[model samples]
Target: MQLPIAPEGKVRFVPSIPLALQHAFAMFGSTVLVPLLLGLDPRVALMMGGIGTLIYLISTKFKVPSYLGSSFAFIAPILALKSSLGLGAALAGAVGSGIVYVILALIIQRTGSDWIHKIIPPSFVGAVIVVIGLTLAPSAISLASGGTHFSYNAFWTAMVTLGVAVVVMVWAKGRLGMVPVLVGMIGGYAFAALRGQVNWSIVAKSPWFGLPHFVHPVWNWQAMAILAPVAFVTVAEHLGHLFVAGSITERDFFKDPGLGRSLMGDGIPTILAGLVGAAPTTTYGENLGVLALTRVYSTQVIAEAAVFAILMSFIGKLGGLLQAMPSPVIGGISILLFGVIAASGFRTLVDAKVDFADRRNLVLSSVVLAVGVGNLALPIGRFPVSSLAMATGMGLILNGAFLVYDKIKPEAKDAVEAPQEAAL
Candidate 1:
């Protein structure tokens, strides 16, 4: 049998640039939303996202079809940093967070994959992921309500954004099929912009090719303290992204590309984003949903998207326009997307085939949800652990430690054997 070839003489091995542009456009709205909420530069975030994609491609030898972008997981920390240290200092903290990723990548390089799974179990991972979504509920509510110390906008914009997001997800078609998040943001913001309150001065002042206002990390103990816990939670999120990408590509990226190298891809780009006044970077799960929707598995497309983000960064007017979007508009969109994220976590537990009939699984999951959602918190002596940090930390420790202990106790001999026998 002979294999067919394209007129361009391209093979399955060839990368498609146009497809990547479509995907980037599809994902870009969500990318900038993180910076907007955290009081950072949306244009810089785009540039960093684009550059971060390039860095990840370089770090991973251009093998994986993944794009690195702003992480929602760090939203809490960025806000906290801004409150205590100021925007410049907050960005410095974001830079510090990237350094932590580099360190984790090194650890993965030195050790093996076994250590990661053994240390952070699926239960812990699920809990941490859940904590990530639930921890932001207050912020989301405040945004939906009309903004607060964190973000500013009327509650109505948030409702509209959220409603539009849900409606689009339910009824969108063809070109509209994959980018519910972007659509919701645009739809909600458009309504808010027309209200005659959106500011265009910054957009007018923004230059097309001006140099990025790069800032170095100041030594901020408080910012560092609050953000440190996020590293543990986010490692799991990154791994989950890697796993999903591997599944789509039909290759264990964790093998050849390696987790450490991939992590450095996430880390290095993040450091650069912060330097230029962007926000913390990570793998966007929404983009993963896009990959699933589009089935475009080539890294070239992701690289192109990265370039779009980079070029878009220099468009000062556009950045100003995006910056001017009302907080309620963003809040409206967040209303649905954030809930979906939490739902995805719940699905992870169900898909893992966790034996809920067993009391052990029940106990672990219950505590994970309660501690994260109920606002059960702690004071780290003189330091005040933000709800986000405390919930994330507690979820990991409670879920990880309990699951490991349960696994070893041998109490589930029958439970463990059931799945094996069924396979036979």
Candidate 2:
């Protein structure tokens, strides 16, 4: 087996570009999808994604290898705010969400992250990671099926893409194996073109150079209230991603960079995204999958990918070309990537040696899977705490209850010994 690359590892420029492109390909579909769904400009989302990633890298002192992308968590809230108020108000809400992250970071900086562990133990963390992967399953499937309805062409295209990816993952050797996702996408796109699915007109019509549409945020207290609470969901997800990434790289990022710094890294980019009229940014699990597959955790490679993304945003033809990628092809790639993410979570459980025989462990895992996989939403005021956030919250509450039980419960062995001594 090839040796894994460390975060600080250096690579020659020629090979590094392809490695960076692999990471860009891994992030491309979903980064743009978030903005498209929310009726925002895809170019702005791509630009913010690259910019946010760079910001995050700097904030973490380039110790953590992650690619920041448009967040899906705030899609509903942003859309709702946009409809009821205006796009400006919705952007304000996103800014407010970033403020929440910053405040949390400040608190963590002072009080430390010990409380975070107390509320979210290892067992709960594993379950929350699993929830994050499972929550994304539907989106993968929807793309595979060609949106709301299933199409035979789409299914076949997805199968071809998935098959190529699997083959590359299992059989390919050396550098080729390191980019199964990118290779699979190329193969899938080729097949899609042959089948007359590729539309070249959009790319042709797009100008070679352009700038993203930027809008300033309009602050409204009501809009802030509606969108700010959703930050809690993304915050829980942010922690889970950090844990998973740390596990993959076999480095304690939380301790090295510290959770406080990581949160600030994430929050700062999100603030920039809102200010520039783009979707909020989050650490992408797709890129994490690439890191796991390639065993390459080089921050330099990620930075290169960010640069590519920023360049892609400014080049209208390039952005349009990516936009024209068939949904089925994206779906096919997603099947493998999303599955890897979930498998990583299971690996976390195994690595931690979590004992399901313990009732506390059993309850935490079972309840989290049920709530998270089932997509149960429990509303908190105007915000509905659902999916990953709800699952994480429920797991934390359950774990906290068990901890309290352990604290308050009397020692039965001591009571029995006392009675025996009295009788003697």
Q: Which is the leading candidate under TM-score?
A: 1
User: Can you write out model 1's per-residue Cα lDDT over 1-424, one digit (the tens) per residue?
Assistant: 1222111122232345556667687768778888788766777788888888888888888777777778887886677666656776677666777888888889889996777776666666676677667777777787777754543447666777787778878998865767778888888878787776577776678776665455556666666666776776677788888999888767788997899998888888877777777777888776766667666665666776788778777877777778778767777777676777787787777777766655545666677677667766465554455566776666667656655766788675456435544645
Model 1 vs truth, CA RMSD: 4.8
TM-score of 1: 0.85
After aligning candidate 1 to the native by TM-score, how far in Å is the CA of 282 from where it should be? 1.0
Alpha carbon lDDT of each predicted model? 0.72, 0.80
Ten contiguous residues minimizing lDDT sum, candidate 1? 1-10
**Model 1 regions lying over 4 Å from their true place:** 1-17, 148-153, 212-215, 358-360, 399-424
lDDT of 2 by residue, 82-124 (tens): 7767889899989998998999899999999888666666677
Question: Which prediction has the highest lDDT against the true structure?
Answer: 2
222 Cα displacement, candidate 1 (Å): 4.6
Candidate 1 total steric clashes: 4
Candidate RMSDs in order: 4.8, 5.7
Q: Give the per-residue Cα lDDT of candidate 1 at 169.
A: 85
Each prediction's TM-score against the native? 0.85, 0.76
